[model samples]
Target: MKVEWKGVMPAVTTKFNEDDTLDLIMFAKNIRAQIDAGVHGIVLGGSLGEASTLLAEEKNVLIRETVQLSEGKIPVVMTIAEQATKVAIAAASDAHENGADALMILPPMRYKSTDIETVQYFKDIASSTDLPIMIYNNPVDYKIEVTVDMFEELLELDNITAVKESTRDIINIGRLRNRFGERLSILTGVDPLALESLFMGADGWVAGLVCAFPEETVAIYELAKAGRPKEATEIYRWFLPLLELDISPQLVQNIKLAEVATGIGTETVRKPRLNLSGDERKRVLKVIEEGLKTRPILPDYKSF
Candidate 1:
């Protein structure tokens, strides 16, 4: 399916049972709400989804369930990340077979990785399935830099049609748009940088916080796409802090807390990634309260 690189694409959180099992019921409801909110697409099991902690079967199951709930109303993009080429390919293919519209793959995490190695890892995944591929480069999370040449090479692979540049380097985004021009769709993953990416020639936003406030995120993207930067910037100013919340040390905890606050998904993140404590919890809640009070969900679309 050809995706519209226009509005926001929420990387929907993977809800889990108290026993740390996949909660398909809430996940399906979240998927339905994204569709109702009129988002461009639904990104399942991505960064906000805590893809790292989920088992392969759980990941596969989540994607399959998302496909079923989506009911072809929206494109389903799965974040399939791995250090092994074969495993990444297998994951991408699995996502595609289970009805994912696209597969976003992160660079293979390595101790001392090179651009050549990163490009090859993606190529390995690209050759596996016909799904449109979006490159995920979150240097903060993955701890690797994707050189411009690596991006250029990745673009040569036709299936590699988009990128989720989660780095602070907005210049690299402009460089890619300058070189590749219309060949690829660049989607910003870093929520705060979404405005910068849109201004610099990105086609869309693959937002993590969108799970908490899809309506606002979608509104911002729509305004940006329609060339209303002034209004979009106003919305972004309100969202900047919320975007920064994902980078918090208690990232998963903050994110889940915010989602629960907004009445989206549960605050149940798996272990090894613990929930926030004392001062950290208070700080996170404070940020959420301030963001909500100031922005206030547009007075409508608040029921979600």
Candidate 2:
């Protein structure tokens, strides 16, 4: 299963039971929707998936289950966000052993590593496993940006195939293309900026809001690629309010609530992160309700 490194690869929410246990039932349901909607791949244990709270064993469970659920129809990519290089390497190995088709790796968590160190960390992990990697270059959230110059150093590793471009800099996409050409694939990580990124030549979207709005997300991607910018913009405009939810700090809870409204998930979050309440919940619900109320009838994107 070679990772194409393009198309909608969702950083799906990790479903949890009331007791905070993994809820495979709900998890599988959402994944089924993604596959049915024609997504290219599924990313597990990412920020939206609450990677920090997930145990290594639990991450392995997610990888194995996604591998089974996708049934070879799509790639299963596990996220590696460990703080220690050794631990990150181990996690990458575990993901490979657990049937993950690829990995989305973050820079050294908590500690801001220097350029030399960051490049080496990524190289070390890529060397440790044969699995292809999509570097998550989100300096906005992670405080460590994989700059274009740094990527020049990383390009030596064939397994370093793609990047989850979340820098929020629209120009960075062009810069990457200018530098690497097609040697490295670029996927937008920001929900709000997805279409813009795609039209600017991004290869795919590592989406967040797609966790709940799989069909709409895939429709936007397909429409954009099909040269139907008008149709894609129409859906993207309607999806803007809901997509904004993915940019917040409470994205996990926000998307889970969207999942509940969309009838594919529950709002059961782990401790230290409670469900949205009071005006906050009301505000978020208002956005979801409005989006649903005005949900457009999508064109036959695949026909394009």
**C-alpha RMSD for every candidate:** 2.7, 0.7
Ten contiguous residues with the weakest lDDT in model 2? 46-55
- Please give the TM-score that candidate 1 achieves against the real structure: 0.92
Question: What TM-score against the true fold does each predicted structure earn?
Answer: 0.92, 0.99
Q: How accurate locally, in lDDT, is each candidate?
A: 0.78, 0.93
* Candidate 1 lDDT score at position 34: 77
How much is the lDDT of residue 153 in candidate 2? Answer: 89
lDDT of 1 by residue, 138-257 (tens): 787778777667878887787888878878788978888887887877888777678888888888888778778877887777777777788778888999899888665566677778
Best by TM-score: 2
TM-score of 2: 0.99
